[model samples]
Target: MTGGRTGWARVPAPVRDAGLVAVAVGDAWLAVSDSSWPEAGLAALACAALALRRYVPLVVVLLTVPATVVADLVVAPLAALFALAERRHDRRLLGACAVLMAAASAAPWPWHDPDSRDRTWTLIQFAYTLAGTAAPVLFGQLVQARRDLSRRLAEIEEAREHERALHAQAVLARERAQLAREMHDVVSHQVSLIAVQAGALQVGAKDTDAREAARTIRSLSVATLDELRNMVTLLRASGGRATELTPQPTLADIRKLVATSGIDAELTGVLPDTVSTPAQRAIYRTVQEALTNVRKHAPGAGATVELWCEGDDVGVTVTNGRPTRPSLPLPGSRQGLVGLRERAEILHGTFSCGPTPDGGYGVSVRIPAQPA
Candidate 1:
């Protein structure tokens, strides 16, 4: 039954109206008493009025009344009453239209004197016609009710989906807060101890190699602690509350980054003042990641960090020489380069990394002065 209704609804409105007009015209032709002009004209008018039923339903119903009384028409008037009932919410108005339609259907054409028997039979026919009019009006009201119910159900479902989304976000915020606490309480404490021990070893060790190794460990541990503190701050701020964030790195910080990188590196060149903050951050991260990779993979290699501007583009290039010693095996997710590429794409820029011709590694990134 639902499929049948869906198929019927897919029919074009004008086509449906044309079909109803055709049905009404056919009923009028079969029921009219004679080929007289008055009767035939009224029947034609009633059928034609069905075309306007959806827009002016009450007017259409009234237009059909003359044809009903004159030519004993049934389909045209009933169809008009159904249309009015479907669109109108006033019960009194619908009741009045239904009564008018029944009266028209039962009345005699060309009024004349009648006997008692004729009057009694007319009364019986009037009651039967009144009962028949009820069917179309009731059915139209039922269809209206079903339409409202369907809309209400859709609204209810949408509200439920929104509530589910909010609940999921709350759960995620709580989990982030818990993770932040664990990093601060346990992970941060452990890394702090490691940094302290490495510092002490660097101070006490007499062998040149041992002191250098301890110094390198201490430097790496301090960097790790700084990053962990930043992460914890961000995670704890995830619950829609405002908090001051740690200042982000920019182009001005590039020189300091190179100095602290613990590798022999040179910094040169200047970017334009027109470079956007995000673009600056991208360039800073590029140099930082490149230098870190050199320390890990190209041990004892010297690096060059160059910042340059050409036309409307500003960029950074970090290139390192081949390692002087074999690099120790280190666990890595290998996501650093992938992340740099994604960031460049977001800023409508370009990033490239590969081995240099001098048996060294190179990382370069160029971004627009004003990103889109």
Candidate 2:
């Protein structure tokens, strides 16, 4: 295991040096077994220099040169050459070291008497020398290549896992959004039914207490409805929170909304029966939110809702006089106005809301009757 900056590169220096020392000592034993004790000492010293092969490759190679020239001691120098190739992929330096080691392996042959320097012996010696030098360099390069490939593969696998995690998160978000929308639809429908029943009870009750109780139920229902609508708006604005498939309220449903609001509200002007469903829904929601605000902020203050078509555009204006009696304002996020403005802008229309000169609150929205 060896590479540019990983694999064997991560091995501690001490451990690496110890491993090289072991290899050098084994080589010395093999070389010195048949040689003189002094030659054995020199071979062992040359091999020991390999302990610092990675730290001082050139120096170790030089130290091993004299031993190799005299006794054919090669293991330590071969190890040094391998370390050099792993550290620096310099072809010229590698070629020079290879040639020097090969020449040392061949030097012993020329010194043999002329009778022993036969052509067959010369070829065998040359081939053996080249294999010894070339084997370490080529083997080191092969190991480095495999280590580098393994690292790249690991990196690619890590990137792929990251992308998969992101994709899973996105899918989960979409599912959550769908759940939110479903919950809003189910809760809102039930709450509206409660409000409608309470309104009917208020209208029919003969006793004062019964009527008051019905009014309280109606008021609470309307407040809950407003809160629900705000929740839906927030979810819609947020990404990957929910999806909705429930039937949306249109201009026809405006009557029921105003009727059950428990506020004095007047609906005026003509609402086109043939308007697009989106425009009708927008108009219906605007009036419903405005009526809710009137009940919460301007209790007992009569409000007016005007719906009209102007050429290519349809419009709705909800205006209410200031509160006639002191009223405890209902808790709200005040996102209704923001939602209305966004609705208008999305249809390339205009929306405005503020206090009028007469101290009344007014909200006006104009959207395309038919989307362009």
Candidate 3:
């Protein structure tokens, strides 16, 4: 039954209207008698008026009344009444139309003269017609109610799906915040202790080799602490509002970052202050990650950090010379460059990292001076 209704609904509106008009005309044809010109004209008017039932249902029902009064026309008036009932919500108006249709169907023609018995039969027929008229009106109202129910159910389902999505996002945000707290409280504390211990060992060590080892450990621990703090800030923010948990790096920090990188790196060039905070942060991070990689993967390598700008474009480049000594085998997650690339893409910029022509590595990122 549902499939049948769906198929019927798929029929074009004009086609359905044409089909109803055809059915109404056929009903008029079957009922009209003796080629009576006036009756036939009235019937035709009622049937043709069915074509406009969707646009003016009340007017169509009124137009069908003349044919019902003059001839035994059923389909035209009933179809119009049904259309009126489906679109209108006023029960009083529908009831009035039903009464009018019944009266029109029951009345004797003007040419007819009725006796007592004929009058009695006419009254009985009137009651029967009145009762029958209720069918189309009631059926149309039912169809209207069903359509409303279907629409309401769809709205409710959409709201429920939206609520479920919001609940899932809220749960995920809470989890990220909890993870950030754990890293800050536990992992950060441990790394801070390691850095402090390494610094103390470096200060008191008597042998040259032990002092150098302590210094290296202290520098790595401090760098790890810096990265961990940044990670915690990001997790706690959860891609929401800006956070003050850690001071975000800007262009001013680039020189300090290079100086403490534990690499013989040179910093040159300048960018205008018109550069956006996010763009500056991207520049700072690109230089930081490039230098860190140099220390980890290219021991004894000297690096050059250059800041430059062009028309509507500003960027940073970090290039390192070939390693003069063998690098230590240190475990790496290899996500730093990937993270830099993602950041660049977010800023509508470009990032590239590869070995240079001089047997060295170079990392470059270019971003807009003022992104929207």
Candidate 4:
């Protein structure tokens, strides 16, 4: 491409030179009548000016316009047209050159013969003509250059935005994988315990503690499943990674959950079974904590867990019937209910708690689930 451009640039030089020689010869013939200066000297200077028109156009104008004045003060002065084309940048110079050229063209008729002077001032016409000819071409070049620069800047900004987005996505993916890994480690280990206990109970049906442990394992497993589902939903909705979105058992799953808690309490679920895991986990956790509460608040009262996954969502109620007496120090995390609400909020779910009409503590959750 460079070589091709070089070749093209070379092609114009010879043509320009030939055109210059032609203009100088034509101007010289017209000027010879003036005989104001030696012909050889004038011709040499004119030839040089014409030849160098492309590069030193101002100089060409300086030399040639005065020469044209001598040669065609009345006929057809011409050097300023080339001047207008070459040095368009200096308006002041352009005006001066224009006035001189026009004066030269019209001068011969007046300076040589007053009766022949029709118009010794055609510079106004020439000036107007020059502006009209150059404005659009120069304006177009300027506009094109601006547009090209704007387009390149826009492209660069878009590339930067794309790179930033890709980088953010990569970071999110890495964090998601890390979260999933952590969840898998925690929940899978819990499930493994449940499965192993089930296997143990199945193998030794005669052991009471094993049976109880098996039941506990079942409760733990059910709760674990619900908690895992809730955890996943949270991970996903929060832009973490819920790619494996699945319905989590809500209050409806608590009966099975508590039945597996290894405690001697009746776990009931009056609510529908389509409970979402976040809700179910909330309820399960409530019962789990209530049981823990019972162990601390009233270890001797028999406990009953009733879950209602009905209406807008699920409700969990735990009553220990006055707990038989007061005690201290629960066997589990004391912040269970707080954690439950925290979990619910994480899922964009709602939670409520207080005493039920029957005097038992009631925990209610309204999440994304069909009523019973």
Candidate 5:
């Protein structure tokens, strides 16, 4: 490409060069300031500007234009016509070129042509020279606009690609979360069953007093196994279709959750019919975590759970009766509520858990119905 461009540049436009020659010759070049230089020599000097016109259009106009104008009055140097035509689009060049032509034509000079109607010809020549020089500036402006538009288009494409990458990242994150939810549903149930069966085996190793404990273990095991099977079946299915995972538990699932805690409880509230699945899950986990804490910290105490929606908001509050005796172990992941509040805040929701004035502990979480 470099070689080809160099070759093209060297291959001069003969028509333009020839035009310079003709114009310079006819102008009868005279010394611009002195008005005495040999006509032929003056012509040679002005015509030289043509060769460098492409690289130095403004300069070429500036030099030849004044020289031709001054020479023209003594010689009416019209070679400036060529300079005007060559860079006619440039306003500054045209102005300089025009001044030269007027001077050259107006200066006293010998009129040689039989057709010389001096006044009329000089007037017409001046007008044409001015118009031609204005050309280069106009053309340059057009070229600049095209380049600006191209640059803007390239920037827009880059911005679009940036947005696309962000979108892809968001989709991938959502998919991973769905997979995690599926995994937990399956594993938690199996773990629960194992715990129950382990308890049963431990109890059955003893006497008649152990029968009641064994039966309790068996019941817990059966319930756990049932939950585990449903979770796994839904996950293994392909084609993005399923049936058994149908009604994943919601806040309403808290009744069974509290029952598992073995605590007497009351639940009341109206949950929104339309809520994002994540928000619903957050609520269930909150209640489940709070109740588990209650069972561990204040076991025989009663708990009151209330959940409902008001307009576009869903609220949940769980409070447990105070512990009369202080020796029970904490039943929940002790640090879990901190993580839970961080989760709620991400959706612009509120979460609070602490001891209330009545001596019991309470947890409250409110999420927007249409949370992001």
Candidate 6:
């Protein structure tokens, strides 16, 4: 990757090379400032050799070795050794550079003077040279290791992020499928009623306009049913049928539900003839589920169904008396109430079911006139 403006771009290879050249020139000038003509020439040659250190580091170090004997031109050898260690991990090259630096450091002292050529002084010079050479090599290896570790960590984080995104997509797909199935149930039930009413109109209507209207309603219902079937096909992978073609229960069907429940049940409500289809369906299902629960859990108890409309909202409450007989050990899927609650909430309605103050179970729902 290319460097960004405020980041790694600040230190390009050309700029780094230029800085190294400047350091080499400064060191050479210091060494030749008060030396003989031969020493000055050698210093200039050593500084020139430093220019090639980044390209052929070993060759440049070898070239600078001769000049160090005449003047202390350490920049070329030190820079070359650092570059070699950073770019190559060959132990032989490092050992060769260390030996060369030791010779150069000892060359600077006056060996002809017996006092200065003592064992202690020679050993000290060799130690200093070895330290200078070894420090740069160790630092370069550390930098390389750090870069490798950082790259590995970045790869791991990227993989984890990809996995998280895939999981979120899978969840979204599942939710959409569930919504489609629920929609098919509700829409199919309402459309079937429209088809039934249109059939009745076709049989009873006297005028031409009324008959035509009934025919049109039947056609529309059939077309809607076809579309709903197609939607279900696309949403589900393998389900028997998208929706039931048979008639579904509505508010008008509550009487039938109560009679078949077998429990002592009481239902009282005054739903408007023009109530919205969704509201009627919700009321019907809530009562039917409550009656079923009463039969399963309270075998012989009485239950009451109360429904009331206040302003723009309609409410239904189903309550049962304490069990009169022993409860049945019926196996329950346990998803009935949860699904009902989800259905109400999706339509911007409220549903709640729990134990009543009278030591019996109660289920209640309040729905808006128009869904949001």
Best by lDDT: 3
Best by TM-score: 3
Which of the two, 3 or 5, has more lDDT?
A: 3
Please identify model 5 stretches exceeding 4 Å from their true place: 1-57, 64-120, 166-248, 261-279, 292-302, 308-314, 321-350, 367-372
Q: Give the clashing residue pairs of candidate 2, or none.
A: 177-241, 177-242, 177-243, 178-242, 178-243
- Over 1-372, each residue of candidate 6 has an lDDT whose tens digit, in order, gives 112354554688777777787898898888778888877786777677667766887777777776676777667667767766766678787777768766775664333654545767767877887788777777766755666677777888899999999877676666655655555545554564465457558768999899999989977876776677677556644332222222556678888777666668998887776666777777777887677677667756799998888888887899998987675333343444755676577567899999988789999998886655
Error of 2 at 74 (Å): 5.9
Candidate 4: where is the Cα deviation over 4 Å?
Answer: 1-244, 247-253, 273-304, 309-311, 318-339, 346-348, 352-364, 368-372
Rank ordering of all candidates by TM-score, starting from the highest: 3, 2, 1, 5, 6, 4
Write one digit per residue (lDDT tens) for candidate 3, span 197-289: 576578789999999999899889878977886787788667322222344678998888788767799999999998998898778878877
Q: Sort by lDDT, best first.
A: 3, 1, 2, 6, 5, 4
For model 1, the run of ten residues with the poorest summed lDDT: 239-248
Q: Who is ahead in lDDT, 2 or 4?
A: 2
* Reference-based lDDT, each prediction: 0.80, 0.74, 0.82, 0.54, 0.58, 0.70
Across 61-160, the per-residue lDDT of candidate 2 in tens digits comes to 7778767776766568788778767665777887788878777766652265555556567568867887789888887777777778888888888999
- lDDT against true structure, model 6: 0.70
Q: Say which prediction, candidate 3 or candidate 5, comes out ahead on TM-score.
A: 3
Instruction: Tell me the TM-score of model 2.
Output: 0.57
Candidate 1 matches the true fold with a TM-score of: 0.56
2 or 3, which is superior by TM-score? 3
The candidate 6 region of ten consecutive residues with least summed lDDT is: 237-246
lDDT of 5 at 186: 36
- By lDDT, the better pick of 2 and 5 is 2
Better of 1 and 6 by TM-score: 1
TM-score of 4: 0.40
TM-score of 6: 0.48
lDDT comparison, 4 vs 5, better candidate: 5
Q: Relative to the unseen true structure, what is the C-alpha lDDT of residue 214 in candidate 2, on a scale of 0 to 100? A: 94
How many pairs collide in each candidate, listed in order? 0, 5, 0, 9, 18, 0
